[model samples]
Target chain A: MEFIFVLDILGVVAFSISGVLAAMRKGLDVFGILIIAFATSVGGGTLRDVLIDTDVSWLTNMTYVYVIIITTIFGIILRNKLNYLRKSLFLFDTLGIGLYTVVGVEKAISAGLPPVICVAFGTMSACFGGVIRDILCNDIPVIFHQEIYATACILGGFSYFALAYFNLPQDLIFIISGLIVIAIRISAVVFKISLPKVY
Target chain B: MEFIFVLDILGVVAFSISGVLAAMRKGLDVFGILIIAFATSVGGGTLRDVLIDTDVSWLTNMTYVYVIIITTIFGIILRNKLNYLRKSLFLFDTLGIGLYTVVGVEKAISAGLPPVICVAFGTMSACFGGVIRDILCNDIPVIFHQEIYATACILGGFSYFALAYFNLPQDLIFIISGLIVIAIRISAVVFKISLPKVY
Candidate 1:
């Protein structure tokens, strides 16, 4: 449980930095940058919680809020330095989504949602923050245009259920499912894999 | 109760039309048009419900979905005609926000939220659908840029509480509060009133 909590915080930090970078790239003011960062770090989980009628996770606990704030500040200060560390940032983002997919799937299952909806919610929880960020930035959401982002989460979600079906230990389920998501996402980027567009 | 139900449906239909028109104007495909219509009609109320931990309104009752579908089809078929009838559409949009504000305020009050938060929720329920529509269309939200949209809802929310404080009947409160919003919005359009930009 404690390990999952730590990973959750790491995810928030990773996503917050990504948001800050996007906002800075867009030349947004400090206030706009902060809002974007905050939204990107929490938007997915907030949407999931709302859909499932759970208390919004951040409102119930302030740790997420603190992490986003700290991340945004550091992200801005190190903006230039961070430009050279894109690969590292991408790794953190990959890990972030991997951990978040498992957390979202578990929450939906605990809420008694059907397996299909649970998997859908898992993908939503991992990707919707970036969706919100891109929308706020007035750009076509990257997920809609390109990238294997949501697909990775969906794959991870299926793996989670598969592992559970085999009666894998709960802790092992978390680690293995998260690794599946991370591996798929990282390989997609490294190998330049992308879904074909209809048009 | 029946009257509020009717008003709720009206609000949904009106916003759905607005969304369909926006999507068509952008030359989006049929699927994109329907998605935007659905989001614009339900996004605000969904946000309110989720924040307050209530069952999502549309998921619990299929009527909202039906209305959006029907509205979207007619809206598309009547797109050219609607351009000439912009005034009527504006009136419907105005009434929709007014009724939505009252509904949101009442729900928040029933849930025992603070008065200020209730008023904020009221405004959110009235405006955030359009916000979602704009975001989905990859544009800066109109509320943040131009117009007196959300301001009218905020004014109506305050009026609702003020009228209630004076011990007005519930029905009269609804009528008077809604009128205040409609009057403010229509006049803003008529006079071309808009919030000033800082930069």
Candidate 2:
């Protein structure tokens, strides 16, 4: 339970940083940066909650919002030292994808959805914010244009269910599933792994 | 029915023109222009359909996609020559809001949603695409940032229901309701009408 909480915070921070980086790249105003950060951190989860008729997670917990705002201010204040920030942002984003995919799948399962739908929802919860950020920045979503993004989350989700079916310990299942996603994403970046473009 | 079909087609063309002009202003490539045009034309309705769990209207009608593509290509080819595109784009956007507000309201009412929800659904259907467009451009959504954008759609929707209650001629009610939205939007733009900014 405590580990879940920690992972949730990491996920929020990761998403917020990614949003901030995208906003900085666009040279948006401070307010715009905050707005984008907030949206990126909460948008996917909010959409998921709304779709499933659940209370909005961020709205119910002020800590998530506070963390994002604090991180945004910190990122802005340290804007000149961006290289380190970029690396951290990528790591955090990948971790968030794993954590969020787990939570989203669990939430859907609790809501009585089928396994396939749960996996789809899980992947959506992990990746839709980045898609929204890219769309808002007038760029094709990285997931659609580049190496495995949602694909990693989706595969991780399926792996999680498979592991659970085999009676793997819950903690080990989570750790292994998350590591798989991170490994896939990192290797994709390192080796330029990408799907064949249809068009 | 024929009149309704014509109005729907006109709305698509008008919205597509508005999207093309917006993309041209951004100096996007042909692919971007086509994407923006299609999104602008169908985005709101698609959102409405998704939210209501109905079949996506435009997917069933490939003509919508074809129309947007043709319009986008035309806009790109005539980019340098279309000095009056700005004025024309505004006109079409206004018409789009008017036509779509009615379409959305009718659909919602037919679906047995309460009146207030119907109004919200109608306004959302009219404005979501432009909001999406602004977001994609890495700008605050114009609907959220300034002007009486969604307000005009709401007012037009109210007029529609009111006219229906008064047993007005169905066809005349359509024209009157749509004209009201156009007038409101035009006035808002010309007079800089907007809600008070939140602090």
RMSD of each: 6.5, 8.4
| Best TM-score among the predictions, by candidate number | 1
TM-score, cand. 2: 0.58
Can you tell me which runs of candidate 1 are displaced by over 4 Å? A1-46, A55-130, A136-138, A143-199, B26-31, B53-55, B73-78, B195-199
Q: List the candidates' TM-scores in order.
A: 0.61, 0.58
Model 1 TM-score (2 dp):
0.61
Provide chain B's TM-score, model 1: 0.95
Model 2 residue A143 lDDT score:
65
Q: Between which residue pairs do clashes occur in model 2?
A: A136-B135
RMSD after Cα superposition, model 2: 8.4
Q: A60 in model 1: Cα distance from truth in Å?
A: 13
Q: Best by lDDT, which number?
A: 1
* Model 2 stretches astray by more than 4 angstroms: B1-46, B49-107, B110-199
Residue-by-residue lDDT tens digits, candidate 1, B1-199: 8877877787888899888877776666554576689889999998898788887766546688789989988887777788787777787788899999998999999999988999999999999999999888787888997888899999999999999999999999989998899999999999999978897
Classified by CAPRI criteria, candidate 2 counts as: incorrect
